[model samples]
Target: MREISLDRLRTLVVIADLGSFAQAARQLNLAPPTISLHVAELEARVGAPLLTRTRGQVRATAVGQTLLERARRLLADAEQALEEVRGQVAGLTGRVRLGASTGAIAHLLPSALATLQRDHPGIDVQVQVLTSQASLAALRDGRLDVGLVALPQTASKGVKLMPWRRDPILAYVPADWQPPARLTPTWLAARALILNDSGTQLSRVTAEWFAAAGLYPQARIELNYNDAIKSLVAAGYGATLLPQEGEGPELDRRIVCRALRPGLWRSLGIACREGDGDRATGHVLAALKHLRQ
Candidate 1:
């Protein structure tokens, strides 16, 4: 059987409403013959006599009433879907998938997301916590719309990176330790340390900082989540080096943050597929850009 057309469905609705073929045609701006053909085609497709004439007035048969009810719902749903698509195209509403490291998600994304909520309330940003490498891979595979990634990443095909923000790395140590105001690699290496997981960009950056000073320090424990690392630091488990993002969150009373002596910095970049993105993605990109310092 052939698929039913919305045009024919609409014609039937108009005829039922007006109860006259000529009146429906005038309302629809269709010829009387075309209107008659529309009903005939609908009846033929359903294999039923859909209309009855009583005193020159038209009305639907039982089967036609059932089909008409369903058709009305279908038509209303189609219209709503089109309106939503139009809203997305206009950058008024959409769901944008975003990827970022746990650290960024904790310290950086809140303000950006708040601004988005204020300005573009219809744009829903879905965040996924991912390592920089994982985020880039997701972008390459079309799984993510935007990624806040560590800078100095290896260039990948079909992905583009834009410099977003740079923050100084700091040492988070137990307050009772009374560490120096500025921590050096040698000073830090001598202490037990909680560190980011080996797979993370921050770990590599931290390693390079220590290596440049001719020191290679082993971590007391390595984990990916920034809050967990800070919790360990607060508990006096070990000190860890992490970026001090945008004034940062309030530190635990037992934890104090210190600047690194050599001023190590962690840089971040926004990554997206290297082509035109949908308007919703562009709106989110703009919101992220507003967070740069």
Candidate 2:
């Protein structure tokens, strides 16, 4: 049997992931025919078809799916080995893919990334804003090197989890409205409520908080961005519950930030692949860990 080619294996993985030969070619910077040839070569070597192409997408067969999984591991291992060598000889140099929530990206991540960039300028950090659930899913799919997500997450096998930070969930209400000093769920629920997107973890937690108080808040509107929620709240649309994020602009003078009764909190933490102990990823994780306060 002919030897399996690593480049072809990587090509197969990218093709399977993107689901388009043209897309895979563009991603790999190869010609479209080259992508097809790579798959053909792999099929010939394994004596089985690896990909079935359709009108707009491509999918792997059973044998191809198994091989694609193995190929990802192999490629990850090879890349780790190269990164290790670079770290030993020069310094940590590689890209670390990270996933975070909008709040984390706005408030928590900048400080850590600032220090990481100052220290290891060689390491490249790619960040995407995703909800905790989405981040966890990406981590399980091996798309993210590290995830700063809301806590109480169930780790997929081979994921290393650590506690990071706890943030108080605060309410934003119209500044002119004198919300009761003790903000009870029932009191808040009696008012028009605005909440995070309906399906987000934050929204779920918010719902639980209301439910625990024997009341429920049916939001007049749900939004994912904090600023937009604040804007809507300031316009007297309704009150909202959000992590206390203060960045781009001053809290709308018309909006009052208040802590909830019973002190609702959200937990966030770092998660990495268990065996990923690569120096580059570790350096980045350590940088984030240092900022855990």
Q: Best lDDT goes to which candidate?
A: 1
Please name the candidate that would achieve the greatest TM-score relative to the true structure.
1
Clashes of 2: 0
For all predicted structures, in order, the TM-scores are: 0.98, 0.68
* Model 1 misplaced regions, further than 4 Å: none
Candidate 2 is scored at a TM of 0.68
- 1-293 in candidate 2: lDDT tens per residue? 56788899999999889898888899999999898898888888888998887787789999999999999999999998987777744545878899987777887788888999999988889999888778778877889989887778776787778998777888889977798765889778889988998867788889999899888768898888877788899999999988764244578789888888988988778988888467888888889988776
Residue 207, model 1: lDDT of 99
**Candidate 2 least-lDDT 10 residues:** 243-252
Instruction: State the lDDT of candidate 1 residue by residue for 1-293, as single tens digits.
Output: 59999999999998998899999999999999999999999999999988898999999999999989998998899999999999999999999999998888888999999999999999999999999999999999999999999989999899999999989999999999999989999999999999999988899999999999999999999999989999999999999998988767788999998999899999999999988889999989998999988
Per-candidate total of colliding backbone pairs? 0, 0
- Name the 10 consecutive residues with the lowest summed lDDT in model 1: 242-251
Cα displacement (Å) at residue 60, model 2: 49
Pairing residues by index, what is the TM-score of model 1?
0.98
**Alpha-carbon RMSD, each predicted model:** 1.0, 15.0
